[model samples]
Target: MPASISMDENMGFQYGVSRPGLNPPIQFGNGFYGAGSGLIRGGLGAYGKKICGSSSQYVQSNISKYFSDPQYYFQVNSHYVGNKLKIILFPFLHRGHWTRMTEPVGGRLSYNPPITDIHAPDLYIPFMTFATYLVLAGISLGLSGKFSPEAINWQFVKGMVGWLLQVMLLKASLSSLGGGEAPLLDMIAYTGYTFTGLCVAVLGRITLSYAYYLIIIWTSMCSGIFLAKTIKITLYAEINSYDANMHHYLLLAFPRNSNPKPRDSQNRRETISLIQKCKQFHQVPPIHAKIIRYFQVQDPFVVFELLRLCSNLNSIDHATKIFQQIQTPNVYLYTALINGFVSTGFCLDAIRVYCRMDNESVSPDNYAVTSVLKACGFGLALEEGRGVHAQVLKLGLSSNRSVRMKLLNLYGKCGEFEHARRVFDEMPDRDVVASTVMITSFADYGLIEEAIGVFNRARSKDTVC
Candidate 1:
């Protein structure tokens, strides 16, 4: 008989294989197992269960936040539809406020429903307008004696293509101009407003074909004006909060449509406040002369903020001078300076800063490591990347996800897939993102089968993978 096994109440098992001799009594229980085929299935099953349970929980928590609930976009009423249509067709005539209404709920400000807020976006009008366009197109075709199922299908396809182009153009424009974090569905709704104008233009063509050109142009202008106003309002709502001084400065520097006229006393006060804020600064070195002179600021954190701003403005030289004024910089300051260099396409300068931080005996954190690794990847500095990898190991940051991902990215960009694979394999829990990265690396290098193999071996797969 096989060795008698005693199962404890706590799921532990004691094997009586060691009967005074052979192999010093094999033991298989409490998460430790001796070499044996009998316990293989049970151990594998237990491990698989733990992994799947954790993976399921993790995916549920993370993925849910990414995809928005569509129900919010569809909550509409007839009054909203009427008001929304008017705004789309005649936006300039709109006398009401453009700001979205909000209400307090659960200690946070939540936007009011579309039924009550005229400025709020909804899918109801878009869907109705799209259907009306399709119907009108069918009628126009029938009137022209060219009506066919295929023609309707083609018109539908055309309309969809136009809608997609609108969305893509709007999204791309927002990305280029920055500060438009409108939801994907909101973009869809905004773009879909074009269909409302299209419906009227199509109706005009069906009724009075001779005046089609005039009608189309008029509708186009109206649509353009409406969209400009709507998108401007949307962008304005997405502005992040800033300190009062920064807010006043921005208003004075770049007045908006809603900015109070400079003739008003209140507006004058705001301008004066901004000037006073600027007057607080003392004259510094010519290198850090421009904005730094206006803000008499010596705090390293403030300098870091200005450094980021200068980088955004493509004034890296000014940022460097400001950085030099700091007597001692922390990891955040170092990371900011490195990031500024990286953003401004000065990868070598970023690497030098990282090295300088190291030379100063300041222990670099994961953020600094990731920033330099990005510089290495962009500059294709394999040797420098390897040195950073060594530092990562020494600093015990090899286990950090961001650090590892950056290292993997650095190696892959430098055509060092072998090292990338080694880094990938060392990860204890390879999530979808890590697997996707490995697969992408393999595919990029023409290793098709290797990419498929990595995908197949992934314990958890998601749409992203």
Candidate 2:
């Protein structure tokens, strides 16, 4: 028989005393409690395991999404390391393309890694250099008879702090400079590059002692130059509005030298020399402007140099004014002005300059023709490009490889695939580059099948395709 049970206020359950004719009261055993608790514990453990696993995966995915793939930054090879080191120490000497290489993957453009592209940033050098810096500091401490584990640990801490500060500073700078959307890993890699120069400075201090000052200054200068140039090309490439101002900042950062007088009497030689010097030093355009104003130089050669410099600086207006100063512009001077306008992205102005040259009866050279063709391509001036092509044939430049290539590019960019194909067929030497260009142009216009046909029919094939 069951025992009579009543609820108690303090205790959850209480067994009442057995009444007459009632069977012995049932006992509440420990097994009951143990089984009940075990059920709850097992359920909770399974739930908690599932929650932890899902939450950890969520956090990891979020981190990866925010920071990008860290593996991309660490993919460096020996050749890439060597070239990267060279760039860090002598940025001005690097003449290769500053933009990263991209390939089509899953129908989207993905940038190649440092192993495949020299322009792509990496983390390997910076990490190694930081370690080297710490080691060098330890060596210095040993030389001074102050070596200790505590001292080495402190150095490590300090180095880490400095690295963090540099990263923060670079991230902030880029944010304010209109590159806030840049990847976090890229910023880290770029800022870490400072350690390379830091390592060099420490080594110099340990070795030379006396020239430590000089070495530090030089290394600092090189590092500044490297960062400025790299940021200029990589981050600022698309910020057209900020490009001129960025050039100004870079101009200020470059080292200065005393001005030199023009060498010859006519000042043509000296004027050209001065322009070259300014170009080399990255002197401000105003300095050249002042020179042009003071010297009142009129030589076509000097004017051409001035136009070239202005073009390089993307100052097409200044280049136009310089061109106006030439009363009777020669072919070279016209070509220089056209090239400047083309380079500065003033495609319409370049076309107008080409027209003006034609009106002035200045014959277009191969360079002038090519520059005008490029301008037409960029401006999408199909009719203008056709006119330039006619001029090319009339001037007997059709056989010129560069001219032919420009013609092919102009037609392809304008979506004139038939013309482009005709030009390709007529090419006496359809090398890999020309064929690749044709195939790429077709592919760009969504002619994948055509591209494949061109590839199959090609006389020679290479990996570049």
Candidate 3:
């Protein structure tokens, strides 16, 4: 017999009496026995009765039973009781219980209920990996500060506040959904912890002041990682659904009606037509060859199209080769390359492209400047960002809204609130962007009241609500 069965039997006899008042005495055969045999049998019997009959045992069994066949206990107090306790005590640990309780009640409980797999490598690994990256970022930023003091600004604090708000929003949304049992406090704590790690990384990358940038970097990194993961999971689920396939095809066929002239209309039409034709005809030219033929004219737009297509196909080398072959690459061409590099998380490469533009004496335009600034942000190149800022001032581009906004953002990111404020004050007109930058700065410094005041003032103005 199985050990559990044997133990149960032994327990059944030792605690044979069903009621507390009743007692059943037994006499064992007189024989040489092992040490403590009577004690062992007695203990086993007592445990069996407790497991099988005690009020606590009954409650546990009922709870598990109700969970297995929820309809049987749909109106039972035990279900609610168990769920309430789980929510209060285990929070994040009992996500499934909360999910099940929230599901529509009429049908038989799902055999394989939808549950988020928390142990998936992607869920936790990226946060940890990015934590290391954050440390590096902090180091890099710290080093960059030696040359670029202006890189540190108030916007970093504001960005940090925005990040914190996002985290709170996410947690609230999750709790509102099926995550009532999710320990929100713990989630917030972990997020803060992760954020700190990232801030350290950013500090290591560039230096303005360790204290403020550290917080901003930490929060930004953690929040960014969490949001990215959540979005990816949601997208994966949506894309994997049967309905999504039909919708995807429909979207491709009809396309959105936003752009006046869809930028890639011809290419899209061809790609879609090619897919449909492939279904009917087995033999067709490779997609690349077709694309090459389609763009035979060598127009800058065509080159851009080919570059975009190649990058989408993960043929970066091919995209680079085509980019190099252009006789006279314009600012747009360089912007495309820079954007492509940034998209691929190659901040260093993007910076190099900006440097090349400088060497060629091609006065980097607004778009180019924006892209390079983004690179500086990513690489934590405070000095480079300051240099760019100086150039913007020299070129009288400081008045340009986009350039000024970027400068505000760059300064804030580097943890220089005063400089960020200076930029904000220098704006020709106080727009929503400028106000938001100021509000964010206050929030980053944990001056919630001040941030709210700014927001209220902006709302009262009603200029750009």
Candidate 4:
């Protein structure tokens, strides 16, 4: 205590300034209070030692459900053979709408072949093809005068081992990313499909020796495409990436001692959950800061989610700002931004983004094509819309149902009924959406009688949009 200082109201606690002719106290009092508080905490801890044990067990018990969440379980059913082959051959045609049955059913389709399923795992095709491949290999070996029982057996084992290695690689990669609860059998089913492509490649090798290389290349590409599409639809979205930000530098120093397994997954889930909450709880600036703190903004999934939330919240300006923050945006991220702009009635902005994406040499997906087409219709950029239609044709996306629907509606809305009618007539499978779009186009172009005919022909008109 200073001799010149007093605890009276007139001589209050002087902090920074020199009181009239008064010397300041040497003690700050903070350290003394802190020491007293530490002693009190220590005393309490010592006293509670007998009653309280380490809380690690308590926390382990409390959070067991989070680690064992049912949502993380990757279920599989593979009791079908026929339609499963169709799925492996052409996944792009998968409409992705599974049918449901209420009463007890009796067929393989009932258990394994979901009516409109896109990515369900199946074993029948792959296993049968593997056996057929062995037979084909034996035949080839016999024809080439290299046939031996031991050699044939070795070839079969080698193929199976290779398949197992592929399964293990995919499983390990997916598991580290918070997926791979899918069963070993489910993975075997997936990896074994490669044999079907191999069987075809062998036939080509036997029939046309010089063209075998072309056949091999084509079959390899198809196999790659099949695997990519299946994994994208089924497992890719289920996985989440860990944060690799510099904030974990200390954790890096003491690796094993500081970091726990599931630490990254927990952090990822928490960060995404926080970002989701920001659409409701925080304004754009705080949310932006939170995002920068938590995630890689350029990650397509994170960008997509943020853009989606911003659009849902009607914050198109914030989405634009976020889109600008991306360094090298991919097609999906660009589509998200374009969708936000188009959905909020910023048609010109959507078109501008589409152009920017084009100049970046990024090819748009079906969603982007449909979205930009709608934007063109709304903006009444008829020539620009026609140019996009030509681009769609050149890109081979003219066959896409959504793209067709958008093109027809765009033409009709711009008073080009002939183009709309051509688009409608060219559809190979004229379903409910196509029919509805045709009707709308006809009405927009003052063809009421044609609209009525389309309305009468449309089946299941419930989901016209």
Candidate 5:
């Protein structure tokens, strides 16, 4: 038996090292210290991966909302990204910053700050950091006399592959946890953050090879902590909300009575609201019939809703039938009919309807002009639209914001830069939308300098250009 050894009550072997001048070293029973330490390390590594994976899962679960546009994800709102790359590399050292949540609507990108945002998952940082890391890494390799383009390319590919693996792991973990349905690109953004941390380690290696290991340790710890904390906070609701709302969509198709009965004001409002929600859904044939039954075939508003929805759905023929049923169509209904025709490639039909309105001497509202001009633009009949512009001027509506924008859009599309610029210049009050339209027009026409000039001279910094 080894000296300075004892058996414990639990049957764990206790050992003590005999030092020349000490009674004995402190006892470590059985595999107490060794096994515990090993287990702790294993648990930490597994837990780190698990938490990080959950973080990815939470993001991807809302993938359509978050990851519909890859460009939007990679695009950093200047307001949010300003002076944050340095801090992003060492996120633990600098807390309390968030990335922008952005969406592209009608060819314009809008940004909003997330209610519970963490900065690490910003695609801007990942994209920029990945590029910068590769550049810095190449420089390091070059300095060490081991530079090769092939090797640098390999590193880039390897990093991307690693990011992909992280996304897979995250997606798999979340799916297993009953939260699978996250966006693929959102997962890409989250997993892609490795570049930010790896960038720091690469810089350290460039400075001193020994520093690489130390910085890597720091970076790994920081990543684990950030992901774990953020995941717990962000996904707590997401997991539960997802489950609760799992049946929400199925419930949308509530049991429709064999015949929808006319109800009270509250019921009518709810029916209209529900119809509005269902407008985007592809199953509109039944919905249209349901709306007619609900209104008992006398509500112009019901017809208006169906018309507008049919336009969006490109059901131009159906909308025309609904339009015919309206005994007295208001400007809103008229505009909806025109918009439906134009949106669904029935620009000629839209124009004929406008001519009929003119014959009937129906006063064309701003929406009417906007819809007609848009129809002209879609039809590529710039000359006809110019005549419509003349009518708009005669009606003293050129000053209308929407009219000017629609007219400007028309001229820009027709390759009439001079006309487009003239309208934009003549606007009494140029807002962000006007500026955005002008810049977009200039860009499309290959007038890069003009676009840049407009961008620089904009009074409002909020323009999408």
Candidate 6:
């Protein structure tokens, strides 16, 4: 029988005897326990391994098992099946363990799935539908004389096409979930779908036709659903990888085992070299520039990293001074400063930075808008928030989803339910974000019934909760 080890409050492991009848190598981590059993099982008192002769066989068997019994299927077998499917679909999902798992139990036997070309039918269908709609809408607009021949900038169209290509490149680099191995292709399909939908909407809005607006809205809803699902899958994949890594580390450092430590050797040298390269490429320069011919073309991402490093080193003054030197401070820069100040309970400083943005005519974007609104929500400066709202409207940014959401939140904070409702009613599209903002607003203001009503309405509209 495999021994069971449980950790104490201090994370010290204690061994427990497992009965012979019980599965061995039963692993427990965080709050969950799993047992392995069956032909591949080591009688290790761990989780049972669901066996499959082939990948297709595995998928078919698992699906049958799941749909056949709803209650016990997911409860008992879903995790293994889901994990296996993830591996089959995205072989690189678990880099280290995948290699180990595929290796033979004892001999040199190797098990690997055949490389198969996969295409996304779900993506293709929506893409084709949206493309058809765009073509029709564009033709309609052209015939209606809404698109003036001289007004049409082929350059802008070219730029938009370039933007689509850039988006595909970005999606591929980011390892977007739905795209998987064919991220570039997947992103291209998604971009086509999004472009067509937006084009149709633009055509409709230009023509001021309600029917076109209705079509645009319907298409948007469908697109949003697909986007949300893609995001969900990506997030799920990330979380699973994180959990697997944690488990692998825990297993390696099992009871009384010292955590692995790094050594100053060739490996360390390689690591340091990599870190320096990353800093050079990805790190932002210090906010301060000492009249260098031109500021080093550092990555904007480096700024956050530098700030984090400064914070860790307790060089608050240095961080602050660097932040002050930013030429065109964006929402991210302001938010970082605001967050640092708020964390240190320097509410006044946070407010001052917010005011500075307006004074400098920088025009606070969504992040800045949200931070200030949050400060108001906490009853720090309701009057200041109201002023920001006026500025937002004057900038003609009130219609932006982010700004509107912030405004909705601010109105709720001020206990102005009517104002919040007006903002909600004014939104061109009542998306999940809009609905959530309203629901959260009601909940925050102790309006339970109103929150529930908002939730019900959202559900009725098929806005996934």
Candidate 2 to truth, TM: 0.42
Off by over 4 Å in 4: 1-266, 279-284, 453-465
lDDT of 5: 0.61
Query: lDDT scores for all predictions?
Result: 0.64, 0.66, 0.48, 0.59, 0.61, 0.46
Ranked candidates (lDDT, high to low)? 2, 1, 5, 4, 3, 6
Candidate with the greatest TM-score versus the true structure: 2
* Best candidate, lDDT: 2
Candidate 2, residues 1-465, lDDT tens digits: the string is 111111111111111211243233221222122322332332334433543565476556546643765777788889999999999988888885566664422212245789998878888888899899899999999998999999999999998898889878877776685543556666677778888888888888888899888988888898899888777666554233223334244444433333534434555666667777663212434445444444433556777888787666555544654555466779898888778766654454565566666655778889888888887676656666766787777779899898888888888877889899899999988888888888889999999999988888785454344
Over 23-94, each residue of candidate 5 has an lDDT whose tens digit, in order, gives: 222212221234223323323344335435654654554454565645545445555565444444555676
Superposed on all Cα atoms, the candidates' RMSDs to the truth, in angstroms, are 22.9, 28.1, 37.0, 27.1, 30.1, 28.3
Model 4: number of backbone collisions? 0
Q: Candidate 1, which ten residues in sequence have the lowest lDDT sum?
A: 1-10
Candidate 3 C-alpha lDDT tens digits along 1-465? 000111111111222223332223222112112212332333335433443454455455446643443333223243433443233223344343111111111111111221222211121222343444544544465665632334333334544575478558766665453323333332333344343345444554354454655666555555455445433333222222212223123234433333334346677676545534442111212443454444432456656655555444433444554665565677787787777666654454565566556544567788888887776665545556666777776667777777778777767666667777788778777788788877886877787997788789778888456
Worst 10 residues of 6 by lDDT: 1-10
Q: Against the hidden reference, what TM-scores do the models get?
A: 0.42, 0.42, 0.37, 0.41, 0.39, 0.33
Report model 5's TM-score to 2 decimal places. 0.39
Clashing pairs in 1: 18-25, 281-296
Q: Is candidate 2 or candidate 6 better by lDDT?
A: 2
The residue-by-residue lDDT of candidate 1 on 266-338, one tens digit each, is 5334433443343111111222333332333444545665666555554455456556656677888889888
Worst 10 residues of 3 by lDDT: 1-10
